[model samples]
Target: MSDNPAADAVLNLVKQQHDVLEKMLNNVSQAGEAQRKAAMGSLERFLSAHEAAEEAYLEQATKNLENMQGWVEKLTELDYTSSDFVTRFGEFQKELINHTQTEIQHTIPKALRDMTQAQIDLVQSAFERVSETAEPVE
Candidate 1:
């Protein structure tokens, strides 16, 4: 479930980080200053990692797909919850679900489906090769 073949390994890594990210963001909303600070560190790391991955993704994806990047930027900017861990995790989960739906139902498939077999092969080979060096997101 964590390893995504359609995306470059970087984005797959980010997607795999989702559960941890959700928990951290939720913690920040519920905990005191000390706990919040710890959660912030986790959030910062997730943000840094996801941002770096997204920037790399721009190179692999078609220009049209950069809009997906913009959406992710907005998503990462959102406060997962305002009052409590439950609410925050809920929000984060909802956003992740929505974004995942879009990626699977439209974005990634659209990019590949429009390609010729040779082009698909090229992209698939590149993904497999890159995946060899990257950690499994799941």
Candidate 2:
């Protein structure tokens, strides 16, 4: 199956946001106390915006994935066989894996514990709606 343009757009946006966040984090680390605090304010806003956009786009892509069946099949269709593509993809994969591991180990659990049931329910509802729209694999 051909790649979905909408999904590609979302993925590109997410990558861009990730780059911005990484840069902001570097700035925070290098800054003085006052500068660090200012950088953190920007980081907070970027993080919140990134999270919301990711959730929305991922919700749609999740449904599309169900229709396409397993992700491996879709991934295989991409033209990542070129050396340049492979190198870049490998770097992205490493960064993504590290980021995901950190979130799973620390960020997600803390957020789950801190959030109210109502807040959790809202997130659950959003995800459920996406799942509901997904076409089951035959």
Name the candidate that leads on TM-score. 1
TM for candidate 2 is: 0.42
Model 2 Cα lDDT, one tens digit per residue, 1-138 = 114333333333344445565666566445554564555456545544444533553343233323222322333344434444344434534554466445434444444455555654554454344334322211
Q: Candidate 1 versus the native: TM-score? A: 0.43
lDDT of 1 at 110: 52
Whose lDDT is greatest here?
1
Measured with C-alpha atoms, the lDDT of residue 64 in candidate 1 is: 38
User: Candidate 2: minimum summed lDDT over ten consecutive residues — where?
Assistant: 64-73
Give Cα-based local distance difference scores for all models.
Answer: 0.48, 0.44
Off by over 4 Å in 2: 56-97, 100-138
- The residue-by-residue lDDT of candidate 1 on 15-48, one tens digit each, is 4454455555566556674565556555655545
